[model samples]
Target: MNIAFRNESLPDKLFTILNGLIITVLFVSVFYPIIYIVSASFSDSQAVVSGEVWLWPVRPTLEGYSAVFNYNQVWVGFKNSVIYTVAGTAINVGMTVLAAYPLSRKDFYGKNTFMILFMFTTMFTGGLIPNYLLVKQLGMLDSVWAMIIPGALTVWNVIIARTYFQMSIPDELLEAAQLDGCNDLQFVWKIVIRLSGPILAVITLYYAAANWNQYFNAMIYLKSQDLYPLQLVLKDILVKNDIDVAMLAGDPADAAKREALKTLLKYSLIVISTVPLLLFYPFVQKYLVKGVMVGSLKG
Candidate 1:
C-alpha cells in the first residue's frame, strides 16, 4: 500500500471523497457550457432553436460557421484583433519586466515609495471622461494607438512579476554576475530573463487575453468601423442585431429561418472568438501555476 494512503484516517478519507465530489461538480459546471456552445455551433439551426441540443449536437451542420465566415467584416475584425493582441502583449510584457526588475531590487532607492504610487493608481483612477480627454489630447482617438497605448501595462501584473522576481531570483546570482563584469543590463538580459520564464509566460497570457477580449476601449475611442476588433464586431452582430440578410443562405423572405440562423451565428461567432485563447493556453499552462503560486504564496 502507498504510505500516504496507509496513513489516512477515516476523517481524512471522507474529506478526500468530499473534495473530489466538489471538484467533479465544479468541472462539469464549467465544462458543460463549452460543450453546449460547440455542439450548438455545429448543430442545425432548427435543432438549436427548438432546444433539442444537449450533450451532443442533435443535427450536425456547418451552416452557422458558413454564415460567420462569409461576412467580410468578420475577417477584418479578426485581423485587427490579432494585430492588437500581438503588439499590445509585447509592449505589456516588456514594460512589466522593466518595471518589475527594478522594483524587485533591495538596493534600489525609493522602491517602496514607487510601489506605493503604483498601488495607489490601482485603487483610484482618473475615471472615463478624464482618461478620454487624456487619450484625445495624445491624438490616439479613432486610431490603432488608442487600442495599444492607453492600457499598455497593468500595475497588478507588475506587482506579480515583481513578487516573482524577488522570491525566485537569489541575491547571490546577481553578485556572481557583477563579479564576472556583467553590468545590470547584461545580467538582466542574460540571467534574470532566462530564469524568469514562468512569470513572463504568466503575464504574457494575462496581457494577451485582456487585449484579445477587449472591446470597451475600441467602442469608446474608435469611431471607424474599419478599426473594430473582433469582439466589437461580435457585439454589433449579437447585441445590436446588425446581421445582414444577404449573409443567410436560405430564402431571405423566410422570417423564421432567418431568426434561427441568426441564433446559430451567435454560437459560431463565440467559438471562433474563443478558439485562439483556448489554443494558446495549453502552451503556457505549465508555467501558470508555478509562477502564480511562487509569487502569491511566498509574499
Candidate 2:
C-alpha cells in the first residue's frame, strides 16, 4: 500500500515542477529585455558597443546624466513638453466631460445626430494636408495654438466617456437633482462629474502622453528650434553626429567626457521622460478604474 501511494503522488509532483518551470521561463523572457537595456545604459559605451556587457552594467557612472543636463536644448525641450502636456490635458478633459454628459442623457434633443457626426470624424478625416491648410488659414500655423486646438477633443475618448456615463450614472440620480431645482450644468458639475474619477484619469493619461510625445507638428509648423518639444530635440541629439562643441564646456577632459555622456544622456533622458507618467499613474490609478467602470456603463 505504501509503494502504491508513493507512485500515485509522483505524477502530481512532476506536473507541479513542470508548471513552475514554465511560469519562471515566461517571467524571465518578458523581463529580460527591460533589464538588459537598463543595465546597458549604465555600462561603458565601449563595452556596450563591443558587446562585452550583457546582463550587468560594468563601469557605471553618472557622466551620462551630467552630460544630458549640461545640454541647454534638453532643458528647453523639457520645458516645452511640460507646457504642452498641462495645457493639452486640461482642454482635452474639459471638452470630453462637457460633451459626453449631454449625449449620455436620453431626453437631450438631436443627441443621436450629433453622436453620428462625431463618430463620422473617427472613421473619416479631412486628410493631413487639408487640416494643415486649415490651420494655416486660421493663422494657427507656427503658434502654440496649433498644437492645443487641433487635438483638443478625441472622438474615441468622447465615446468611452459617454458609454461610462450611460452605464454608471443612474437616471434617477439626475432626476433627483432636477427635482431639487438643479440646472443641467449644475447637475452635471455637482453629481455626474463627481462620480467620474476613473474615466477622467484614463483620459488625462492618454492626452498628456500624446502631448508629451508629439513631434511631427512641431517639425512642420514651428520654424524656431526654441519652441521644439522634447521628443524632437531628443531626435536631433540622437541622430546628429556633430553636436555643438560649445555644448561640452565644463571639464578639462571634455573629449572623453562627451563620449561617455552621450551614452548616459540616452539612458538619462529616457528615464527622465518616462518618470513623470510612472509617478502620475500611481496617484490616479484608482480613479482610472472607477472612471472606466462608471463612464462605460452606458456606452
Candidate 3:
C-alpha cells in the first residue's frame, strides 16, 4: 500500500471527507420523504393519523387501495386521465417541435422579432377573465381541447428546443444537406431530428407530466362527471371524504375492516397517482438532462 503514489496536487484527505458528507446529506434528503410516504401509505389509518408510522409502517394494511378501486368513478376518472394525457401530449410535442425548428436557425429572417413576440407573452398576459371569456366564446369551454389548445405552444419549451438546436446541431450539417438537394422539411426530418434525442426526451417528459397531472383545466372547462381526470376525482375524495361506505370493505358488516380499507385507499391514491410519472421518467431521464442542457445555452 505504501508503494502507491499520491496525487497530492489534487487535494486528497480533507476533500474526500467533505465529499462523503455532501453525498450522504444529499442522499438522505432525497430518500427520506419517499420512504416516509411509502411507509405511511401501508400503515393503518389511525396509526397514520396519530403519526405512529413515521419511519416505517405499523399495523400494515391494504384497505386504502380497496377503497380507491372499488368505486366505479375512480376507474372512469383514470381512463379519462389517460385519454387526456395521450392526446394532449401528442398535440403539445407536435406543435412545439414544428415551432422550435425554424426559430433555431440564425439565418431565418425576422427570427429575433419572432422570439420577442413569443417572450412577451411569458412576461404578461391578457388576464384570466378575458382568456376564460375567449375560451367560452370559442365554444371550447366544456371540451378537452380547452386544456390542450390553450397550452399547445409553451414559450419556455420552444426557446429551450431552439437553444438545443443551435447548440447541439452543427450548422455544417445543414449546409451539407442543402448541397445534397435536401429541402427544409427533409433536412428537419432526416438531419435535425436524428440529432435531437435528448431534447425530444426532455420535451416529451414535460408534456407527458403536465398532461398527466393536469386537473385545473378539467375542473374549469368540463362539467361532465364522466370526463373528470384522476386528480379531480382524488380531490373530491380527499376534500369531501365522500367515499361510499359500502365499497370500503369486502363486507359492510365489519366496521373495523371498513375503517382499515378507507385508510389504505387514501394511501393508495398517492401511490397510484404517482406511479405513471415514476415509470415514465426513468425511460426518458437521460434524454431529459441532455435536452435541458442543449436548450439552455446560446450559440
* Candidate 1 vs. true structure, TM-score: 0.92
- lDDT digits (tens) for residues 193-243 of candidate 3: 788887877888898888888777788888888878888888887667777
Please list all clashing residue pairs in model 3, or write none if there are none.
63-261, 64-264, 64-265, 164-294, 164-295
Model 2 Cα lDDT, one tens digit per residue, 8-110: 6778868867988999999999988877767777776666666777788878855556666788888998998899889989999999999999998899999
Error of 1 at 115 (Å): 1.5
Top lDDT hit: 1
lDDT of each: 0.92, 0.79, 0.81
Q: What TM value does model 3 have?
A: 0.86
Give candidate 2 misplaced runs (Cα > 4 Å).
1-26, 239-242, 249-257, 284-299
- The predicted structure with the larger TM-score, 2 or 3, is 3
Off by over 4 Å in 1: 1-21, 294-299
Clashes of each: 0, 13, 5
TM-score top scorer: 1
